[model samples]
Target: MAKQTPMMQQYLEIKAQYEDAFLFFRLGDFYELFFEDAKKAAHELEITLTSRGGTHDRIPMCGVPYHSVDQYIQQLIEKGYKIAICEQVEDPKEAKGVVKREVVKLITPGTVMEANLLNDKENNYLATVADFEDGSFGFGRTDLSTGESAVTLIEGDLNDVIYELASISAKEVVVSEAFASKYEDTLEQQLNLTVSVEEERELPESMEGLCSELEQSKLIETMAPLFHYLIKTQKRSLDHLQKVTYYSRNEYLKIDYHSKRNLELTETIREKKKQGSLYSILDKTETSMGARLLKKWLEQPLVDRKKITERHSVVQSLLDNFFIREELKDKLKEVYDLERLAGKVAYGNVNARELVMLRRSLHQAPSIRIM
Candidate 1:
């Protein structure tokens, strides 16, 4: 290997830290990708593949303007690429050598919080499966967009996990190191999941005597590795994360793939799209969160007649008052997606426009109270 320039040396150092991700090395106004990253990105994005400073051995390179980089990121993520955004940490105007740059955030398809890159009506989930010695699977899933987290124990084989995950439609999955090594091919071939491996580790010793017996039992060994990976990559306190929802496999009605397809509950079997489906036809939601919650209700319909009647009573009350129902619907239209907005705020990514939207949504609360 030839000696690297000071700037290139800095790039290499940062690049070494995030080998799995495509490094978006910030240089002045452009985010540059060197060598293999450049080659792959150029090929995938169909952008100009060029080179940088070497007379005899030029390095492969590609770049996009920082202002227009989000679209490129969206494209890369759609192609199942993780991106490490290296930003200029120190101002170049006062830099002694090359302006110091660091990876600010790592963006993956499952962890994206950008409104433009995400579907408003759908939850983006990252799921994890841990194989147990007893042949059961400990499953964990979280939607970083909505801060919803759930875990369950599936008392069957990998096929059971695959079936559940397919229904959830998760963008990514993580598994224990042992599980990944053993079933990597099976998971990939069967579900076509972007599976990542995490080391198996015990929960912190300090928390051993901290909680009730129920909470302690709910703290499964599998959850630690997945949550650790998320914390490391996210590099922030996931304050928005909800309580770990431990559930039994039999809590909800089990709808198989064929049944979902035949019933056309959410998507048509032919087009595999939501248009003309039951959800689309019955979806009278005003906000993104409402749409998502409605979909969830449809997917997991309650079997308990008492709970069902409670929901029906609310609907019956509204149905009885036509004027009030009309007024409530109009008021709901004024509100925005509070759930996702709150998630973005907790993630420290909410902007001025989003704040204004939040205020507008809150303003509708008073009118809604009239119901």
Candidate 2:
């Protein structure tokens, strides 16, 4: 073995922190990957697999231009890989040694909020489950794209936990390092989820007020870790996230993964297309918000007859008033996807075009209100 270069040594130090992710070290206009990451990325991305340094001292390396990195990231994400974006923290012209670098962001499938990388029709959720001291278990789930968060406390067997997870269809699952092994096989083989094991911490005393408000003191054990993880990874205030909506399985009609597929409620059983699904038949929705809300209602039908009747009555009125119904639909067609737009704004990723779209979307509110 030969001595490593100063730049390589610095890269190694940062790489150790995110061993599971591909580190994209920013170098001028490109983000470079070295050693094993370079090899893997080159093979997967089918980019030029080259080397750095002189002959015997050479190391495998690959990179994409900074402007085009998103396309490369999308490819890696589709292939189920997490990316740690390492950036130049200092100016190269001023630095005496190798310019300082640090991981600015970590991109995972569930956490990606870019419109191009996400499906507008579906939610991408990251979930967490932890067993409490009592027989009960606490579950936490969130969709970063929609700024939605929910928590539930369930007391049952491991199968019961699995059942709840199946219904939500979370893309990623987080658990304490010690508890990871217990459900690793079940999560991988059965649910096809990517599991991430993180260190656990005692429930924070600061969250006491929030827990009291939600009447979910028990969720402190399981749910707090998810909030902690998001804060750490995002490194920003998630102002769009609503209060944790505390719910239970009994709150909605229970539907398992197999039953959802069998019934073709949201998607067709054969090709998984929406054209022949129940959703397609009933979907006269003009806005993305309406479409998503309709899907949620279908998936979690209310068991309460009064609530069901109320919804039916509303629909009946809309159906009976032909001109008003058409007016409402016309106005709704002018509305954009406000939920996702709000999410982007909360995440501090909204641009001028999106802001214009949001403004236009809101302008339709008056006409909708008139209906």
Candidate 3:
């Protein structure tokens, strides 16, 4: 048996906290991976796998340069792998034996905010499911990039939960340990969703305001796990997160999962591509926000005749005025994704370029309103 190095000991301590994710341990100018993380990342990233001399034997090691780490991270994210970015908190010169390191960020498929990694036209949702003792389930979802949160109480079984998740194209799902043990395989293998477990069901006091509109305890319980998971993984101010919107299946036209797929409403059933879908054909939206809204409308058609007629009347008015419609489209094209930009601002990650975009987008608001 050999004693572990001080650096290795620190790495192990931090890695234990994020055992399910690839830990990118910062060393010098590189973000290194060791042992199993090293081997998997090396194979998945096609990076050179090397070895470091340990007290007993050679230890597997691989790393990517810090400057070019985003590309590697993007690749792993596309494959649905979570990454814990552990950075050296203190300078090496100031350290006693080993420099202090901590995980600054945990990038999951659902929680990604990088512009290059996200699809501008589509939302990436992180969902949470709560199994009630009465056979009903509470399903909550949030798009971290846009800070949009919503939840619904499904008076059905796990298949209904799956249908809701599939319809929304959730990238990852959070559940309790018991729920994970029972249905993790179906979620991961069948739907290809990344499953995360959270045991906390109590909603935090800071986030109580977000659920003020909800009266049902079940809905609040569902959102609590999701809110806690966000607090844990994001470790940032979620002020931009909107008030949780509660919806019912009766609010929308009832469409089963198989029926939605067969209808080719959003994507083709055969190729599962959006190019040949009804959404692709009907979509003439100028901004990313509009595109996302259009997709949501297609998935959840209005059941209320009054609401449907109101929407149709608005469309008809636009159709009647070509010049105004064209001007509105032009103004919309000049705008950026305000939803996500606001999220970044709330998360305190907004950069100078994004600020410039935000300014430009805001500048067009008056003209858009006049039209």
Candidate 4:
């Protein structure tokens, strides 16, 4: 017989729903994992690998304490893992038989909104793509913490959205229920984006002829499952995405991938990002994760600008010039949150850390006052 704990049963139920992402089964003091997730996290995070005493051998198990979750989260995130934090919604002592555990948060390299898990000048983004209107679809997204919104209308090109999303690497999708099947199939075929669900009653439904056309999009059969990040952005894309071309006021920072590595945007200015201290002003109060992510993105923009810019000339004069790149890469998991940080800074919700990072990056190239 399969040994069953109330907790295990609950876990299985949630896992069935969130099949694509790792479930952090929250117990009293630790965030637990079961089966394959347990084995993977145990090996990767160096946690104590244990097991559930089941009749047929045993079920895999592993976990990290709530206190040290931040560090462990960093390791998993760095390895491109997505963790769904399932926590006890009520005190076990006051609960019936088993405690109520719910997914308090889903942590992906992108869309992180926690403190102690984020940095300054960084942004975390989650985007939604949809197929709508006569074989044509649109894409839309918003950085909740930074108020950065995006709407791009893609025409007749499903893969175009996928390619664009891949270029930007949107971390999650608020999918529509109607086109779930085709969206899943297409995303798998075209972009290799996995799927997951968040029961947000707030997600908008798609209208128009998008339903049938998208459900009928051609499917390809020979692509490999390209697993980059653990938390899935979409099983398929959700309903219809918003307009696809306009840039949000506070959008994901862009410098082209080339600029992020060799050239340092913050070489001209160097300051550490701290929370609630002198750096508090720049701390993304809306979401610190975005702040930290933005900081790194600014240091290492993803672009192909000229090698010798005036700002590069200034940064090249420093001794700890390499810190610019180090900090950038060290914080590269989800620079999506850069938009949130930008918004905060733009609205004067920041400090020296924000100013320094922005000044250095802006110095390198031409002024970027988006219309």
Candidate 5:
């Protein structure tokens, strides 16, 4: 019937493990998809979704050259899909059976590292909860999307976590066993999260409120036996929440949609910076988050124009003024505050990069002293 390549068997196995994610099966020169994955990939990728060696009928097939897989992967992830990048760990030319294929990386909407999938101006948040007693131990949140983050130590009863989760709006979450038990009851309640109780850290039942948080956050990973899911929610009512002083309004400033109408429109940037062709830009090299940020910035430069200009000038000055790019880069590396960087970039502080472009503006060539 059909030629069942050894790789196909391995693909099936890996697919079983990651039902939520599409398997980007890596072969010699192409990354292929089979069965329904093929149909889906074909429609989404808009490329030829053909089939491989025909069987009793035909095995569905769709593929992209290994070199071009990045673009395809970026698209799938942006579509809110999880992608299990199954790569060939062994040399396909020499391997005997199915040329070993194992998932090298799993790119979910919440945890993606591709430069093409991130924004330099916004945060990609991942939240975690630890409820020891009443399902309100609060949460620890980080968003590397824009390389900036925000976290709130929740108070109140069990429902407080829900409000906090809604406020923070993180994409993924990890819960402790003690906290999961606190997840809220009321089956009719829906907040949007993947909740999984930890088996090893099992705590008493007082923290049942945390269960809602777990369910909404999708408890992406478990320390013992965790659960995971995609977070999708829009309803927000910040009730029974207290504010912490460690935060400044600068961190919470909003960029109006009308203002962000032209920061770095992906298509425009690509066209203008395409070097030879009008269809090219450095965007292909940027992560999805970064792309979104650039687009957002392009759409609303005035939101924080002053800071944005600063970062812009910094980078431009460096490229135009110095030759010590590497040494200056080391200095920029000293900056530990991504949120601060994001603020500067959002406000058009493009010159911030100048501080590290060619040399350290801070260290300088030794200031001359007057006699």
Candidate 6:
């Protein structure tokens, strides 16, 4: 084998850390991929595969422009591939030797926050499962786009956990190394989920506030692995991450996985599409946030009579006053997805246009309240 160049050495070192993802190593204006990554990305992304001259042999290489890389990333993410965005951290003019490049972000299907990639009507949830010795499991889910987080204890077998995951339509699942080794195939084959492993289970003090309301240690244990994975991959302040909500399965109406599919509550049974689902039929929500909430309500129908009655009374009030209902609808139309906007703000990715939208959404609040 030929001796590797200084830049190639750096790329190899960084690539070793993220073996599973395609490393988009930064090279000036283009984000290049080398070796197997280059070949795979070239084929998957439909980009031209080229070669870089090495000392003895040619090395496979491919790249997409940095400015237009998001489109390519979106394509790979849709195909359930992870991408490690290696960016030049230091200026070439200021660097001592090769520019300091690092993996700035790891984009997975569940962790996608880009506006163009996300669907306004739905959430992208990253879930985590922790199996206990007694046969029960802890399940936690978070929507990075919406800052919504929740954890629940499943007092059933792996099938029960799989059912809950299916209901949420999770794109990816994080689990312990042991858990992954045991159930990774099942999760992947059954739900077609991207399974990630996070060995950390201890809850850090800084994130304690996020789960302060939860008294159960099992809930904390379940949420910790997810938190660790988010912190590791995101590498930023998760300020928008809401306090983790804890819920028991008994609180909501129980529906088996088969029944959920048969009823087509969220997606059709045969086609597995959302067009003819119950959610789609009943959805008259004007805003994206309302649409998401409506789906959640449908998926987990309230079993408690008090809660059910409260929701029914609210609906009755809206029906009683036609003008008020129409006015509220108009106001809601002016509102943006506040949950996701807040998430972008915390992620430091919110642009000026989104900020203006946020302002406009806030302006509708007073009108909504009056109506």
lDDT for each candidate structure: 0.81, 0.83, 0.93, 0.52, 0.51, 0.91
What are the clashing pairs of model 2?
A: none
What is the C-alpha lDDT profile of model 2 across 1-371, one tens digit per residue? 67788998899999999998899999999999999999999999999989999967689999999999999999988766789999999989999988999898888876777898987777788899888777788888988888777888888878878877777767777788767888787786788777777675555454444445466567666767877677667765577776677877786898767788999998899997889999999987887778878888998889888889999999999989999998888777778889899989988889999999899999998777766
Model 2 / residue 58 / CA error / Å:
2.5
RMSD of 3: 1.4
Top-down lDDT ranking: 3, 6, 2, 1, 4, 5
Off by over 4 Å in 1: 203-219, 366-370
Using alpha carbons, what is the TM-score of model 1?
Answer: 0.92
The reply for model 6, stretches above 4 Å from the true place, is: none
Q: Give per-residue CA lDDT, model 5, range 140-198, as digits (tens).
A: 55443243333344445545556445444445565655545545332114444444333
Over 51-136, each residue of candidate 1 has an lDDT whose tens digit, in order, gives 98858788999999999999999998876678999999987989998888888888887788889999999988888887766777
Residues 1-371 of candidate 6 have per-residue lDDT tens digits of 57888899999999999999999998999999999999999999899999998455889999988899989999899888899999999999999989999999999988998889999998889999988888889999999999989999998888889988988989999998888898899999999889999999899777999999999999999999899999999988799999999888888998988888899998998888999999999999999999999999999999999999999999999999998999899888889999999999999999999999999999999878776
- In TM-score terms, candidate 5 sits at 0.50
Best by lDDT: 3
N/CA/C clash count, model 2:
0
What is candidate 1's CA lDDT for residue 301?
75
Off by over 4 Å in 3: 54-56
Best by TM-score: 3
Q: Measured by TM-score, how close is model 6 to the native structure?
A: 0.96
Give one clash count per candidate, in the order shown: 0, 0, 0, 43, 81, 0
Model 6 local distance difference test score: 0.91
Residue 122 lDDT (model 3):
92
- In order of appearance, the predictions have TM-scores of 0.92, 0.92, 0.97, 0.51, 0.50, 0.96
lDDT accuracy of residue 198 in candidate 2: 64
Please provide the root mean square deviation of candidate 6 (C-alpha atoms, Å).
1.5
